[model samples]
Target: MAGTNRILVIVTSVGEYEKAGYRTGLWLGELTHFYDVAEQAGFAMTIASIAGGHVPLDPESLAHDVLADLGTDKRYADREFMDKLTDTVPVADVDVEDFDAIYLTGGHGVMFDFHQSAALESLIARFHETGRIVSAVCHGPCGLLDVTLSGGEPLVRGKDVTGFSWPEEELARRADVVPYSLQDRLKQLGASYSTAEKPFATYVVEDGLLITGQNPGSAKAVAEAVVGRLR
Candidate 1:
């Protein structure tokens, strides 16, 4: 009951597929920016994953060019951040209603595991029912695939949301790993998914308790929206 203001962040534990084989997990910078904004707003935060342990990271996203202008925060190396990823609670072990908000963080890895997990589906449903903020960014939104409200409609139906667009995925694709596009899936779920002109530009949509960010560039904006909800 205490720490009622804490936010629960979900990241994917699965790495790149054995066949496609490229590094992937939570987008490091995106998660850090989100935690920074949430913590600064005085909300405690905890990280969770489908498997409950260490999450992977995408190697390409760690390049100097990507981190140079914007994603360079050292929170990526912080002990606290590292601890959260390694010791994350399993989605099945946590009570979704304990937190005020749930933010799904993403990387290509999420496309591999976030969508098919029943544990995540249950959590999202509970969070939605409680009217708490339920958000995701980039491939993170893939996790929303199975979330159905009490009436059995896709939780995102009629909601204003955004995620990694198909074009962006094509632009960022590696030769080996190909992930399902979040943009397409969200539209299929009846979400009014919208975004900015390009993939990396910041874009976010807020519809009641649902919020989504388009890509890594939108991490800060996503955090700001979560903070806005709390206020």
Candidate 2:
């Protein structure tokens, strides 16, 4: 991969959803799909987490049925890829200048930590201010909630964006378990949020340098959108 094609992939370090009494972390499909797309486009990728080391995988994302259906599950079994998830760089150690784009991967676990990191928020702002591509999928958009550009305006304000919808959250039966509704928060931040008519469908919204996806199904589309922008 060329130096100019470097991409930073950020995933949550949080491993469990205590309130829901279930394991939750990076949604495997979300990260895997986007990663495959980016890598095939000749981009060098680095995995990072809010707290660093041992990024967790949401158990639900690794269900046998889910893995079998996607067929791309071999990515989960790939030793090199799995090893990368075992030890991710801390967000604080990341140099924003090294990447051409920054992507946020999501899971229910992100709702617990993605939005609360001041360091991650600052890195995102820098990425945006410098005109690098900023992309996220599903609950990944939660990371954008508190990001402000150099002029202090919310990054998503007045921008067209989409993430895991409230309806989808409700459909997943995690409405109460999540810390907050990502769709509602993005709307409150002044983003023009939209989604597919049905839950779990592909929906990608690109607003200049920022791109977002509505669900796991939208992950590849979101990455392709970012690749298009980079080109």
Candidate 3:
């Protein structure tokens, strides 16, 4: 309760899965899980997107199997929560000083744009340099891929992190269309990337101020860890 009590929830604005001839966007459960947890802890959230406007939902993420235990049934039925995705604040328009932390929510769509936004990179770098928490879940870590700190090094360099792993990508049957391997990119950047023993199992890593979750199953834990950091 002593912190700023603010959180910026970043989502993917890209919905085109042209490679797979389909569309993908934010994984609803990823956002819902983290949003629910942090909100309960009294954190006010601002949902943002790379380019803003509307955030498409990964159609597969809404499957009953994925949403069954995510506690999102109520959110899916709540227009207030669902409407936040319809018109998200663009990252460039955000006031960096308004938040204490930044959370990147994932879906395959992020693979296309998370690393492409200079504004997002700058905002993340500002958060990192100021000692504010920079966290991501699943493919959301993609946002950190290109962010470089004032010291002239990639923010992820030499840090312990995790996201949707390569094997998990294969398991999710998305290895073919995800643009690039998040696990590989993390390792390529010198991050000590890790994952749960089994794909999709909840896993979170906290290396200093950088927090990351392995998959959607890890979203709640990631947010809890962020809440703990704020406390």
lDDT of 2: 0.89
Q: Rate the local accuracy (lDDT) of all candidates.
A: 0.82, 0.89, 0.91
Candidate number of the best TM-score? 3
The worst-scoring run of ten residues by lDDT in candidate 1 lies at: 68-77
lDDT of 3 by residue, 63-150 (tens): 8877776688789889988998889999999987999999999999999998999999999999999989999999999999999999
Q: Best by lDDT, which number?
A: 3
Over the stretch 121-143, how does candidate 2's per-residue lDDT look in tens digits? 99999999888989999999999
* Candidates ranked by TM-score: 3, 2, 1
Candidate 2: worst-modelled 10 consecutive residues by lDDT: 64-73
Scored by lDDT, model 3 comes in at 0.91
Between candidates 2 and 3, the one scoring higher on TM-score is: 3
TM match of model 1 to true structure: 0.92
